[model samples]
Structures are given as structure tokens and as C-alpha cells.
Target: MKLYSQTFKDHKIVFIFFLFFLICQGFFSTKIQYERASWSNVPKAPARTAYVLSFLGDEALAHRVLSNLLQNFGGSGGRFVAISDYDMDTVSEWLFLGNSLDPKSEYLPFLAAYFFGASQDKEKLRPIIAYLEEVGVSGGKEKWRWLVQAVILARFELEDTDLALRLANKLASLWRPGMPAMMMQMPAFVQLGMGEKEASYQIMTELLREEGDKMHPNEVNFMVDYICTRLLTPTQKESDPLCIDVP
Candidate 1:
């Protein structure tokens, strides 16, 4: 009977302790749910070489995981977080790290260009633009799209036409076989935006002469019309063969 009594007491003690734990857990959970939440800055990227090595040399998996984490970091905990609230420097680092892990994946660049690139704080876009530019330059023909995106973000989002022109020029210089003709014409378009009519004319003229056969009919017509209507005076258009009969 004494042993039985002792066993019952032990069971009762465990039950009471478990009940207390539940009560405390519920209290803390309720308090935490009601507590004011603040936006947490994005964490700094880990050392690239070490991080990849730690993933058992599966760099692809490492970057994929990082990409997912970055996408979720902004909207974590079911909270609405603005892009402006992010620490762009750290975000840039994270993106760069992701790229280093998987240079071929466009996922990180897409996020850099569209997601965080939409920040209302225009200045914060600089790092993102820089990141995209690096990806474009290093990625070469296969990754030219990132550079194009960088130019767009610089021109429209940041309203920095000079920087846009510089990027456009780089993109034009890097033009390769099989690249879209429209993309090759970015420099001329940017030049026109900056009111450099002569430069734009020269670029378009060179493109038409060298790659006109590769361009679609609509693209060629668009270029001809733009050059004739926008870049040249009526007198010049009348004499220029490319502009002749161009409406």
C-alpha cells in the first residue's frame, strides 16, 4: 500500500508540473502574439566560400536555399514589410552571395531587379543596380538580360539618365550574335532620352547596316521611323535613303 501511494504521488507531481508548463506556455504565447512587432533588418550574408563549403560542396543547393530565405525574409511572420524598410546594403550582399553560389541561376537577379528594386527609396536601388550590373558583365551573353534590367532601373526608377546611358553603352558594346536586336538598340534609345540626337542616329544607323537582316520587319520599321521622325530634320529626311518614303 505504501508503494502504491508513493507511485500515485509521483504521477500527481508530474501532472501538476505538466499543467504548470502548459499554463506558462499559453501565457507567453499570448503575450508574444499581442506584442508590438518591428521590422527586422535583413541579416548579413555569410562568407561565400565557407558557406558553400559547409553545404558539402553542393553550391547549387546552397544558393537555392539562400534564395528562398531571402524571398521570405521580407514577408516573414505573416507581416507586411515594405521594401524601403529593408537594409539595402545587407540585401545586396545576400544577393551577391546567392549569385556567387549559382552564377547561372537568374532567380537571384530577378529578385534583385523586380522585388527589392521596387523600393520607393530610389537611392537604395543603387546597390541593387550595381549587383545586377556585375551579374550582367560577368554572365556575358547568357546573362545580358540582367544588364538590360540594370539600365532600366537606372533610367526609370532612379531617373539617372547619365548612368543609364553608360550602362546602355556597355550593353551595346557587349552585343553578340543571337542577342535580340531590340536589346542591341538600347544605347540609341538611351541617347535619345538624353537629347543626344546625333549619337542616337549614328548608333541606329550602324545597327541597321550591320544587323538589319537579323531584325524583324516591325523592329526595322520602328527604328527607321524613330530615326527619320525623331532624329532628323525634314530636309535631312528628304535626302537620306533610309528615311526616304518613311512615314
Candidate 2:
């Protein structure tokens, strides 16, 4: 009976120790997980040649892998990381590296404008916007749409009308013969938003003279209405040829 009692006591102690160990392990694991969930760090991108070499000299494969990694960088471990927690300058560097690897890919630009650009920290958007502009300009007509997005991020997201107008002007400079009228008229729109109605009027007038046939009828009518009803005085509207019947 004594021997049986001792064995039972020993087994009970062993079971208690095992339970205690599991509790401690769970506590520490939860602590570690909480800490990880609370903070995130953005790592700098590797050099271009080193990155390509790491992927067995396949630049295309490198770009694809890097893009995927970037998309999920701060959101791993089943934890949510706030966009504001990221160091956007470092993020911009990674984006630039990705672009260098594949300028033809729209992946990075899309991520830059829509994903990272959505952050509430508007100032951080500067570098990302600049990256978009660089890619948009260098990538030519096919990529010019990114410039439009950048202009939007600057105008509405960043609330920097001047920057928006500057990007709009840059977009205008890239305009070709068959391009959309909205692309060429982006500056005037930005100008109107900035309350530069006269400047906007002058731009629309030039567009009417230069590209009227190419512009859609709705676009032309909207411009004419804006000029006659909103911009010109009653006396000016009476004499202006475009405003003659625009009442």
C-alpha cells in the first residue's frame, strides 16, 4: 500500500509539472505573438546584381518573386501590420528596385499607386508618387495611365494641388496625336480645382482650337458650358463666339 501511494504521488507530481510547463509555454508564446503583432519593420532591398544572382541569374524570376514578397512583407505570421507603421522611404527603395528589374511590369506601379499610396501618412506618399512618375514617364504611352493615378494621389490623397498640376502638365507633355483628351486636359482640371478659373479657361480654349475634332461631344459641351455659364461674365458671354447660344 505504501509503495503504491508513493508511485501515485510521483505520477501526480509529474503530471502537475507537465501542466505547469504547458501553461508557461502558452503564456510566452502569446507574449511573443502579441509583440510581433504590435510592431513591424521594413527591410531595405538588396542590390540589383546581388538580388538577380540570388535567384540563379534569372532577372524575370527575381522580379516576380520580389513582387510577391513585397506584397506580403509586413503582413506575415497571421498578424496585421498597420500601413502607417512602415518606413515608406525604405518601401520606396524596394519599389524602385522592383521597377528596375522589370520596367515593363505593371505590378509594382499598381502596388505603389493603389496599395502604398492609400496610407494616411500623406507625406510618405511623396517618394511613392515620384516612383510612379518616373516609371510612367520612362515606360511611355502604355504606362502613362500611372501618371494619371499619381496626379490623383497628389491632388486628392496628398492634397497638394501644385504637385497635382505639375504631374498633370507632365502628363500633358507626353500626349500624342491619338491620346485621350482627358489626358491632355488634366492640367486644366487641376487648375480649376485650385480655383485658377482663368487659367483653366485658357487651357480649354487652346484644347478646343487644337484638338476639338478629337474630343468627344460631351467633353466639348461641358467645356463650353463651364466657360460660358461659370467663367465668363454676362457681357463677356454675349460677345464670345463659343458662348453665343450657350445660355
Cα-based lDDT for every prediction: 0.80, 0.79
Candidate 1: where are CA atoms >4 Å away? 1-6, 9-13, 36-39, 194-247
Window of ten residues with lowest summed lDDT in model 1: 191-200
Q: Give the candidate number with the greatest lDDT.
A: 1
lDDT of 2 by residue, 1-247 (tens): 3556667665777899899999999998987774655444788889998999999988899999989988887888777777767789889899999988888887888778667877878888998899889987994536886787688778766878999989999999998887667778888778776544455466557656755675457656765886788678888889999998786
CA shift of 143, model 2, Å: 0.3
Model 2: lDDT of residue 155: 77
Candidate 1 per-residue lDDT over residues 1-247, each given as its tens digit: 3556657665787899899999999999988885545666797888988898888999999999999998988686668688898999999999989988888777888788767887989999999999999998895435776787788778767878999889988888787777667567887777666545665576568667756785457657866886899779999999999987796
What would the TM-scores of all predictions be?
A: 0.71, 0.65
Range of the 10 consecutive residues with the lowest summed lDDT in candidate 2: 194-203
